[model samples]
Target: MRKTLEEKLVPPVPPAVRRAMLDAREALPPGGADVTARLFAAMKENRDAPTLPSSKSFRDAAASESTFRTLLRCLARYAPHICTSNAVTVSEEWYARRPKHVTMGKSTPVQPTIWPAAWRALAPALDAAPIKQSSKRRYRASIDRCAAMVRAGRASSDFGFVAAADLADAFLFNADATARVKPITAAGYLDGLIALGRFGGIDRVHLLPMQLVAEDLREQAAMMPKNKEARIGAFMERGGFGYAADRIAVCLRRAESLPVHSAAGRRALQTAMVCAVFMNKPARKGDMVSWRIGHDIVRQPNGEWSLAWQQGKTGKNTEAGVLWPEVCYILDLWILGGRPDRLVYHRYHELEGLFLLSQSECQAYRNLPSELTLSAIGVPSHDLRTAAADYMRHYDPEHAANVISAHLGHGSQKSGEAYRSECSAAAGQSEWQRSRMIWS
Candidate 1:
C-alpha cells in the first residue's frame, strides 16, 4: 500500500516554515508576494524538507531567479538552521538596518560583499556606476585574476601601476601552472583593472597607456584574418549560393505550406522571418532575441512597419529601420497563431516578447549554433550581415562609410570596416565581370 509519487509529494508546509514564508512575503515589494507565494508552492511539492541554497548555488541562481533569492534571504533570517550560506547572516543586518548604501532591485535586495579593506575602497564608485549585476560579477572576477597574478609574483603589487609588459608575460606565457590565458581574456582583465582605477579617481594619463596595450591585444585577436575565401570557395564548389535568395523564398513557401496546427512548422516560419529581418537589418543576435512586438516594432496607419533599434553593446539607443511588408505578414502569422507564452512580470506590460520559444523548445535549440538550417539549407547568420554590408559598399560604389555605418546601426565608421574588408575579394570579381561585358 505504498503512496503514489504525487501523494507522497503533497506534504503541508511546517508551522515555523509557514511563518518564515509569511515574513518573506511581507519583505517583498508590492506584487512580489505573489511571485514568492508561487515559488514557495512550487518548492513545497518537493519530497525533501526545505533547506537553504549553498553560497555558490545562491550566487548563480540569483542572476536568473531574483525572486528565489528574495525568499531565500528572508527564510535564512527567520530559520537559520535551514540555510547555510554566509549570505543569510548578511541578510539579517541588511533587512534590519536597511543601510543607505544598499541598492534595491525589483526582486532581490542587494547585499554588500565583504571584500578586503583595500578592495572595499573601490566598492563605492563601482556601486554608483550604472552597470548590471552580471557585469559587476565579471569586473570582480577580473580584479581577482589580476590580484592572483600579483600574489603569484607575476605582476606589480599595485593594481594601478601594473605594467603592460607584466600583463603580456602573465597572460600570454602562463607564468603560473595554469594554461596561458586567451588574449581576449587578458584584454578584459586589463580593461576591468583600468575601469576600477578610473572610477576610483585614478588619473586618466596613468590608465590610458596600459589600456592601449589591452586594446591592441584585443584588436589583434579579433581582426586576425580568417580564411573565409577558402570556406566560401569550397561552399560554392558544392553548389552553394546558387540563387540563395530563391532558396530562402522556397523555405518561406514551405513554412507557409505547413498545417496550421503544427508548432514545428510555425517555428520554421519564425526562423525564416529572423533570417529575412537579419538579411536586411544587419541586426545582432541579442537584438533579435530580445525584441518585443509593440515596443520595439510598430505598424503604422499607412500600412508600413518600422523597427526601433537599440544596440545594447554600442550604447546607441535610437535608430530606425524599415520592416518589409512580407516580413510583417510572416510576423503577424507567427504572433496570432504561434501560441506565445504569457510572461507575468508587469501585468500592464504588453507583447510577451517577439520570438517566444517554450522552455523545452529553448532547450532543444541550446546546442544549435546561430546558423540557419531550414530543410538542409545551412548558412552562417553572420554571412547575411556581412553580405548586406558588402553589397552596400562593393556593389554600390557611391555608398559612403557613413551610409554603411547608418545601415549597420554602428556607432562609428570604424565598426563597418570589417564588412568592407570582407568584400575586398569580391571587388576583383565585379571588375572582371565589367571587363568581360566591355570585351563582348
Candidate 2:
C-alpha cells in the first residue's frame, strides 16, 4: 500500500510533544478530550507541521461542530501550548477580543404617531400577549439579536417590529451573523421572528421561514427518540455511571462513606446526601432548591420524616411523605453540625433555604450542588429524576409510570408515559435477569 502524504512527510512524535498535547486538553470540556487527543496525535507525528489547524479548516473538518467550538474555547485558555505565531489566525479568542457588535438600548413604547401603523400596533399586541416570563425574555432577546444584525449591516431596517423577507434573510441565512450558531439556536431565532410576526398581525403565510426552520429541526431530532430514560442512561454511561440500579447504589454508598471531619469532606458528604435524596424523590433542581426547612421538612405524628414542596415546573403541590430511614438520618447529620465544632457556624439558621452548602461560612448561600462525582462516576442532579423513574420501573413495572408521575409531581399521565417508554428497554433487561436468576 502507498503511504499517505501525511504518513510519508511526518515522522513519529516524541514524548515532549505528547505531553504538551495532553496538557492543552485539560482546558477543554469533557467531550473535547477525544478530539484533542486525535489532533495532538497527528501534530506529534508531524513535528514540523503547525501545532493546531487554522480555525476555519479545523472547524470545517470537525465531525461535530459543537466540539470544534469547545476546542476553540480551550485553545483560548491554553493557546500558548497549542498554537504558535504561525497557527490559526481566526481563533474564537481573536473574535472575542474584538468589540462586541451587539448592543441594547432602553426600550420605550412605540409612538403610534411617529411609526408605521403596522409596526406601532405591534407594541400593544406584544404587551397583551399571554406568555410566560421566560418566553417574554426570549422574545426580547430575539428582537435584540435582530436589531444587532441591522446595526452590523447584515439585515434590512425592518427586522423585528414588522416581519418581512429581510428578517428571515438576516436571521436564517445571513452567514456573517449566524454562521457559527447551531441549528437549535437558529430554530430559536425563527421562533422569536414568529412571535414578532404574530404580535404585529402579519399574514400567517409570511411566517413560512419559522415553520420551515421548525420542520427542519424536527426532522433532524427525529433520528433519536426524546425519551428521558434514554437521555439519562446515555448521560450516565458517558460519565462511567453504570446502567444498573445496583451499580448506582454502590457509587452512592461509596460517596456516603466519605469522612466528614473536615469542612471539605463534610461538604462532599452533604452534596452526596442531597444527591441520594434527589434520586430517591426524583426531584428537579427547582424543587431541591426551593425547599424551606420548617415548611418543606416536617416530622409526622408517626415520627417518620416527610417533605411537602411546590413543584414550580408543573405548578403542582407535591409531597414525598414517606422518606427512607437512611435519607432521614443523613438529613439529621447535615442539619446538626456534621463538621467539627471548631469549624461549624450558625449563620445558616437565618437562611430560609433547605439545601445550603456544608461549609459553615457559606451555609447562608441558597443553591444546591447541581452535579455530583462519585469516584469516576458523575451524575447530573436533573438526570437523577429520570434515574429514579428508571429504578422504580425496573423494580415495580406494573405501577411504575403512574407512581413515578405522582412522586415527581407530574400533572398528567402523558408525562408519566414518556418516562415509562424510556424505561421499557431497561425494565425488560431487568425482567430477563430476574427470570434467569430464579431458574438458575
Candidate 3:
C-alpha cells in the first residue's frame, strides 16, 4: 500500500492536487502562492493520505535536509537554515501523523512513468541536430535580470489604449539614437538618479532584454520531455538553444587558456570564478551553468536553460516538497539540467557533438572528489569545494556564505567553511569553450 502510493504519486493522484503538488514542490506560480502554507498542511496530514514516501525525490533536491526539516520547510514555506521559530510546531505535528508500513514486506520496483511509453517508440534514426556554444557571462546576467524583472512590474507592458494622435506624437526610437546611449550606460545614469525598487535589493537594470543585438536575451533554450522527472540530458542530446560545436569549442578555449595547468587546474580556476559570482549567495554544483538541469539547453521565456535534472540521491518522499526557488531555478537552468531520455538515448552522443570531446581521466565534475588523490600534491574535490568557500570568506568577504552555499548546494554552513582558505576555483566541464579566442 505504501510503496504503491509512493510510486503512483509521480503522476499525482488528483491532478488539481497534482498541479498544486508540483507547485508546492518545485515550480511556483508568481503571487497567490499559498503553497508553502498548504504544503505544510499536507505534510502534517501526509501519513493520513495512504502512501509510502520516497527518499530519492527529496534527498537529492538542492540543499535537501533531514526528513523532519523538509516537512517543516513545506509547512513554513522556508528552509530550516533560514527559518527562525514558527516552523518548529509545524514539523512536530508532521511526525505525529505517521502511517504504518506493513505493505513493504518486500521491496518492489517503483512503477514506470508515463514518459517511457510516450517516448520509447522513438526511432533510432531520428534526424540529428547541431548544438552551439552558450555565453556563460551572458547566460548568467540574463537569468539574474529576468528573475529580478518578474519581481518588478516593468517587464510586462500593457497596451489597450488606441489614440492615433497620441501614438503619432510619441517619440520615434531607432538604432541611431539608441546607439548614443547603451542600456548599460542608461542604467548607470538611472542608478545615480533614482531609487531602484527592492526585490532582491540591488536595482540593476535587466540587461538580457529582448531586441538589442548586444543586449540579446541571455538565451539558452532546450526542448525536452515535459515530464518533470525526466533528466534534461535526454533533450540536450539532440541540441537546442544555438548550442553548437562552434560555441562549445569557444567556451572550451576559454577554459583551457585560463592560467591553470591541467583540467583539474582549470576546474580549480573555474571554481574560483564561481566563488566570485556566488559570493553572497548559496552555491551548489547544480547552481552554475556547468551543472544546468538539461545537460544541453532549453528555450525558456526568460532565456535559455541548458540543463534539466532530477537528483538521484534524494529519497524519502516527504523531503521532496521543499524547493528553494531562485536557487533551484539557477541550478535547473544549465548545470544539473538535461533530459534523462537524452542520457538514455542511443543517438544523444552523435547529436550532442560531445563525442569529439575527450573524456578526462576525470569524469568532469562527476568524478570530482575523485578517489584518485593528487598522486602527491593530494587534495580531493571536497578540498576544492572547501577551498572555494574558504577563499570567498577571506578574500571576497562581502558576499554571504549562505548565499554562496545556497548557490553551491552544500548540506550545511560547515560547507560554508570553504570560504576560509586560499582556494582557486575554475570552470571544468567546458573550459575549452570558455577562455578560447576565436579567429572567426
On TM-score, the leading prediction is 1
Indicate the residue-level lDDT of 410 in model 1: 80
Better of 2 and 3 by TM-score: 2
Question: What is candidate 2's TM-score against the reference?
Answer: 0.50
Better of 1 and 2 by lDDT: 1
Best by lDDT: 1
TM-score rank, highest first?
1, 2, 3
Query: Which residue pairs in candidate 1 collide?
Result: none
RMSD of each: 15.1, 18.4, 25.7
Give the range of the ten consecutive residues with the poorest summed lDDT in model 3: 158-167
lDDT of 2: 0.54
User: Candidate 3 clash total?
Assistant: 112
Model 2 stretches astray by more than 4 angstroms:
1-128, 138-186, 196-203, 224-270, 298-305, 336-349, 352-377, 420-440
- For each candidate, the alpha-carbon lDDT, in order, equals 0.55, 0.54, 0.30
